[model samples]
Target: MDSAKAEGFAESLVDLINKGALAVMISIGHQTGLFDRMAELKKFTSQSLADYSGLNERYVREWLKAMAAGKIIEWSSEPAEFYFPSEHAAFLTRKHGSDNMALYTQYIQVLASVEQSILSCFYQGGGVPYSAYERFHEVMAEDSRQTILAPLLDQILPLIPDLTQKLATGIEVMDIGCGRGKSMIKLAENFPNSRFMGIDLCAEPLESAREEVRRKNLTNIQFKQADLTAFRPAGKFELITAFDAVHDQARPDLVLRTVYESLNDEGHFLMQDIDGSEHLEKNLEHPFSPLLYTISTMHCMSVSLAQGGLGLGTLWGVEMANRMLREAGFTQIRENRLPHDPMNCYFIVRK
Candidate 1:
């Protein structure tokens, strides 16, 4: 190997290792509300920050040192003070809404929890189930709330012409793989005239969805636990939605076909999926390729395989998704993108 190239690669590896450690620290900072508390202060000592946040001072001090070393927070040697810059806090705090990168950083720890199981799957043939991962649904619900629910009314719904007006005028709508039913509940609350139903295979999140619906006193929305692979609706829907749900299914093709058949003749299907390509070469310049693939291997693909389903993986890509849609009897399809979300692509399809 060339000496120069070897040295450059060695440096890159060191940077990667440090960034990985920083990710875990960032997750802790976000979860413990340290970032939020620090954002409220201009400059303070570790003990003062811990007192303000009501956390253990020793642990807080250690985390602060890690953040300072990583250059995530400003450090001053004169009086041993630290400052969490507003500019950095903008993307780290929950108050920042969908722009919060700290929320996404939690996935690094979540995925790391399954490292042993994933390693076993490497040597063995089977995969880890969804139930194995803790707080996964919770994380996914927060992710959906920010990415989908936050933009549903102003950005997402308008993708299909006259869709909002149709919902306002009363239409039967269904959301497949509706985890926690946040989207359906939001829609039901906004458009009281329309009837909404959310279906998923997991009962835990469905129960949580029902609780939220009851808490909101929403009569227009309902939740059901059903396997999408063999789902058959008693009544067809005027609108169907699948937000980042289809690709990881045991049988995405079957699920898509069912969605096609379960819709009215004039119904519209709004699907949001990962924005990628079928070819590996095409993803060379992808911003989140490494993270996306790691998540797929650890969670998405493994869960599907555990169910004895097709491990389609997360980056099934636009070409593969379009071909599958067409095969499922969708002839008219249009792809759309939003300014806020760069990770997914939206599809407007009509039967």
Candidate 2:
């Protein structure tokens, strides 16, 4: 091996390990509200922060040391005070919504919990089921509410012209893989004239969705637990949406075909999915390829394989997605990118 190349790789590995540890600490900080408490205070001692957040002081101090070492927070040795800069807090605090990336760090621990099962899948050629990962839907619901629901009304739905007006006038709408039904509920509340249905394979999130609907007294929305691969709706929809969901399906191709069949003649299908390439070399320069591929292996691809279906994975790419949409009988397809969301591309298709 080239000595320089080996040394470079070794350094990279060290950095990776450090970042991994930092990720776990960041998750803890976010979950414990330490970050939020720190954001509120200009400067604080670890004990003070723990007291403010109602967490144990010892654990908070240890976590703060890691954050300081990770360069996530500023430290003063003389006073033993830590400062979480407003800039860093912008991306870590829950108040920041989709910009709060600390919410995503939780996935590192979640995925680690399934490493053994994933390793077994590597050896045995089958896949780990969704039931293997605990708190997945809970995490995904928070992610969706921030990323999808946060922008659905302004950025996402506007991708199709006059779509918001159509929704206002009462059009049939359905969301596939609508985890927790947050997006559908949001739309249903905004457009009382329109009816909404959210379908997912998991019953747990659907139950949560139903509870929210009841709590909100939403009359225009409903949730159903159904396998989308064999999905058949009683009535066609004027608008169908699948947000960051299609790739995880056991039969993405069949589901896309079903979406086509379930749409009215004048209906539109909006899909939000990862952006990359069918060709591996083409994705080499993509910034988030490493994280996206890791998530695909640990969750997206594996879940599909559990159902003995096509493991298209997360980086299914624009070329493959467009080709598949055309194959699904969509002749008019327009791909749009949102400035805020760099990880996914939005597809607007008409029957």
Candidate 3:
């Protein structure tokens, strides 16, 4: 037996197990505002922190110990005080907004909810359906608000020069798979002269989006619950966007073709998708490649397979993305990546 290889594997497995437990705890800390509260205090006892955060003292103490053991927080023995390092807080706290690492930790629990279905799919040929993921839209909404919304205005849009100005002067904009229509809402608010339409298959998110439109008195934006398969826009749009929406489609090829046809001559199609390599070997080098593949197996790929669709899965890298864009009739395709967002790659395509 190769004893050295076995020992290395054993240590790696132990580290993986530790990280799994820490992920759940971090999710708890994020959801309960414990991390946010801790960032406000310099040093605090379990009781004090629990009081400040309005959580149970006993539970808070246990959680603090776990965080300390995970090397996420500072621990002291003399007074049993815990300190949330400012440096660490930058990644942990919601104050960093979209830049927070704790944001994606919520996926650990969401993915766990469908563990049995995913396991069943492993043995069987079929896959877990979208209906099985009840909290997916909510989780996705939170994820989008944090990661996409803030940057959509200042960072993402500016990539297409004069795009914002064009919107301000009134242009047709369509966002496919616009969960809760938050992205469209943000754009509509910023560019009131532009008309916007957001389409998605899920009714729940569309309903929520309508509520937001009413609440915000947004006149330029609208949402519709429509399947992308047979989607035929009334007219060619000047701008079309799909944020983290292309990878999991039942027929992404068809959707992309439709998007190509829907754009006017010289119109722009900005698509945001996972930044990954098509090959497993290349993907192995990425830090979050494991998580990306796990998410695809559990949710993205499975849901598409459930619909009897093309399960392209995540890690459909830039090469495949560019190829697909070309096949869909986009001759001028440019890829861009944001420094702050490591998870996604932007493809700017023109008809």
Candidate 4:
């Protein structure tokens, strides 16, 4: 091969490695305050980092090379120091802001484990740790509770006139796949009189959720480390909700049946999921649609399938959801948007 071509190939190989490696590397960099340090120091040099962070110079040198190559940090040619993307400071490093970097730790850390989950596990009846399911929602809560998700849910959530009436009377609700408890927390905050329960299998995250639950001192919020199909409610809840998790379960049919049984006579099952518009062909001109579609595959669909999860929708879409509710013994079904997905429908099934 030509020298130029060979050099380009080698450079591309290194770049490919950064896709997975960057998550961990950036996580460490972020935690060590490397990003912050670079911003403050306003230059790159192993000597500077060694002195600033009090680390060995060799380690700093190696790290900075990757950071520079990754374009997460840059070497100022004139200043001969390192710096970060100025705008990233607001969202990537800021923890308290609604736009937070916590997703780095939450989502990236599990890339391997989630990717390894096999579709056969669900079909052959292999068991998944309760923890994985728990983790799914905890992470899910972060996405849905984001400023965008919340605003969307706010627009969409209020559309359920029946559920709203029940919430006004201090009714109890359960979020079956309440990842990180974002929905539970949001519900708790919005309806102070209403009580909320979250069920998931992952213990590691429930610990985190439990802490958040207590930190909020939300007397009404409760969490359980149990499988959704087996985790029985104490009694009928005024509302039983499962967000985007029904598809990830081994038996969404069974879980839906259970939700039907656990709901009060007139209680609603408020389910939120990605719009089936994923099946809709991509808009070649707009980049985001195809991006979401692929994400729906590798990260969302692939991982869920690996972990005994059904594809994103078995009974998740409007027509299928209507069918599932009827089969599960619900007498009435209403589909509406919950402000989260404009095209996605939140189905309310009356017992």
CA RMSD (A), model 4:
5.8
Q: In candidate 3, what residue range of length 10 has the lowest lDDT sum?
A: 125-134
- Angstrom error of the Cα, residue 110, model 4: value is 1.4
Ranked candidates, highest lDDT first: 1, 2, 3, 4
List the global CA lDDT of all models: 0.92, 0.91, 0.90, 0.65
Q: What is the Å distance of residue 174 in model 4 from its true position?
A: 1.1
Q: What is the TM-score of each candidate against the true structure?
A: 0.98, 0.98, 0.97, 0.67
lDDT of 4 at 313: 31
| lDDT, candidate 3, at 144 | 93
Which of the two, 1 or 3, has more TM-score?
A: 1
Q: What is the per-residue lDDT of model 1 for residues 1-351, given as tens digits with 9 covering 90 to 100?
A: 799999999999999999999999998998899999998986999899989999999999999999999999999999889998999999999888889888888898778878899999999967888777878888889889999989999999999889999999999999999989999999999999999999998988898999999999999998989989888888999999999999889999999999999999999999999998878899879998888898899988988898888998999899999999999999999999898999999999987
Tens digits of per-residue lDDT for model 3 on 60-164? 999999999999999899986899999999998888876688867888888899999899988986777766785788889889998789888899999899998
The local lDDT score (0 to 100) that residue 261 gets in candidate 1 is 95
For model 4, residues 1-351, the per-residue Cα lDDT tens digits are 599999999998887677668767776676576666766666557897779887788877888888787776777767677776666655555443455553545455544454445344445634344344324555555556663344534465665675665675699888887667776776787778889899876666678778887888888888898877566778888888777667656567778889988988867787765445423543344334543454454355554444566655322345566677789898887766543244345666687
Per-residue accuracy of model 2 over 1-351 as CA lDDT, tens digit each:
799999999999999999999999999988888888999986999888888888888988999999999999999989889998999999999878779999999988778878999999998987888878978999898889888989989888889999999999999999999989889999999999999999999888898999999999999998989999887999999999998899989998999999999999999999999988877799899998889899999999999999898988988889989989999999999989898898899999997
Question: Candidate 3 at residue 165, lDDT?
Answer: 89
Each prediction's RMSD over C-alphas, in Å, is 0.9, 1.0, 1.2, 5.8
Q: Against the hidden true structure, what lDDT does model 4 obtain?
A: 0.65
Model 2 ranges with Cα > 4 A deviation: none
lDDT of predicted model 1:
0.92
